[model samples]
Target: METVAQRQIHSLLAKYGESHLNHTNELIHFICIPAIVFSFLGMIWALHPLAAIAVTVVSLLYYFRLSVPFALGMLLMSGAMLWMLSVLSQDQVLKVSLAVFVVAWIGQFIGHKIEGKKPSFFDDLRFLLIGPLFVLSFLYRRFHIAY
Candidate 1:
């Protein structure tokens, strides 16, 4: 059975159409997402585990409460990037990843244009974080996680 949290995320993804993201946008998102995560993790990892955990909790609270769409976008990008990184050389991959990040963000701007509405993240920052969890939840649903 899906947790209430998972169900809420799924409801949003269903409305938004996960596969609807542009192909190029998807590629760009993947390349940049993980880089950001690791970089942040690296910064916090040196601290005691409890302090790191605190930072994570605070960060997540910011994410879910603030910019959810951007967050979801990051999640999808992170998953795709993980797969790409496993195959590519480090230097070349970083360069490619940077390029993709720029392009994908541009694509997001374009999407908002088409929608005739500002990005949801602009309204509620949680949407940015929610975006990533949204993507992750898809995998759970696909594998038939009891949810």
Candidate 2:
């Protein structure tokens, strides 16, 4: 029997997937989503490392409530992003993050244009967070991992 949490995740993923049916859009998302997440975190890190850490922690807590597997995946991904941010000088981090963030969002919009549908987040803000899990769930399926 699917637990309440599992059902909720399933429903959210299904809703998020509705607008992402185009192959080109899916491909664009596969690249741009991670870039957006990383650059977003990088920007926060530039402001203050602790702020970025707190964001990650809070995001992980949200993910954990939805799905432990996804939470773990995000934990690893966020850790790697944080480590990469540490490699940059504080000044450079903001510049690079700003550039990437702008470009990635542009790519996302273009993908949506090709998809002929507005992003799911426009309907509901929580879909913003759901987007990452929607992408990660693909990898989980490929590895035959239950999420």
Candidate 3:
């Protein structure tokens, strides 16, 4: 029997997939989603490292409630992003993050234009968080890993 949490994850992924059926859009998302995430985190890190850590902790807790594998993946990903941010000078973090955030969003919009569908997040804000999971789902499938 499918657990309620499993059902919820399935339903969310299926609904999110509706607008992402276009191959071009999926390809675009494959690149842009991670870029957006990293840049977004970089922005928060720019404000204060502790603020970024707090956000990551909160997000990981939510992901853990949904799926352990996903939470673990995000934990690793978040750590890597934080490490990269640490490599940059304090002044550069905000500037680089803002630039990447703007460009990635533009790419996302262009992808949606090609897709002829509005972003899933426009209908439901949770889809913003789900977007990363959606991308990770593909990796999970490719590796025969169950989430």
Candidate 4:
């Protein structure tokens, strides 16, 4: 029998896949999504340490509700990003994060343009959260792990 996570993952991936059918777009997403995640985390970290912690906690909780393995992976990834942010000088954190955020978004738009479809996030804001999981699903497939 399929788990709740499996069913949800399938639904989310189907929605996410609609706009990501182009090979070029997929390649672009492979590069940009992680950058966007890290940059967003960095920007939150720059606001205040507590803000960053709050974001991480809320994000992990959401992922946990969807799937344990995905949540665990995100926790590890988020922890590492936060650690890297912690090491940066206060001023550099905001600046570097801003730069990456802008570039990554540009890449996202370019991918969408190539795909000839608007981003799924525009239809439902939750796609913002779905994006990372969509990317992770590919890795899960590669590793032969059921998401």
Candidate number of the best lDDT: 2
Candidate 3 lDDT at 25 equals: 94
Residue range 57-126, candidate 2, lDDT tens digits:
9999999999999999999999999999999888899999999999999999999999999999999999
Flag clash pairs in model 4: none
lDDT of 3 by residue, 14-128 (tens): 9999999999999999899999999999999999999998999999998888888889989998899989999999999999999999999999999999999999999999999
Q: Candidate 2 has what TM-score?
A: 0.98
Cα shift from native, residue 45, model 3 (Å): 0.6
Runs of candidate 1 exceeding 4 Å displacement: 1-80, 133-147
Can you write out model 1's per-residue Cα lDDT over 23-115, one digit (the tens) per residue?
544443344334445433333433333444465566555545434543544445544544445455544544654555566566666655554
Regions of candidate 3 where Cα sits further than 4 Å from its true position: none
Instruction: Provide the lDDT at 63 for model 1.
Output: 44
lDDT of each candidate versus the true structure: 0.50, 0.95, 0.93, 0.90
Give the clash count for model 3.
0
lDDT (Cα, tens digit) per residue for candidate 4, span 84-119: 999999989999999999999999999999999999
Model 4 weakest 10-residue run by lDDT: 4-13
C-alpha displacement of 57 in model 1, angstroms?
13
Highest TM-score model number: 2
TM-scores of all predicted structures = 0.44, 0.98, 0.98, 0.95
Q: TM-score of model 4 relative to the true fold?
A: 0.95
Lowest summed lDDT over 10 consecutive residues: which window, candidate 3?
Answer: 1-10
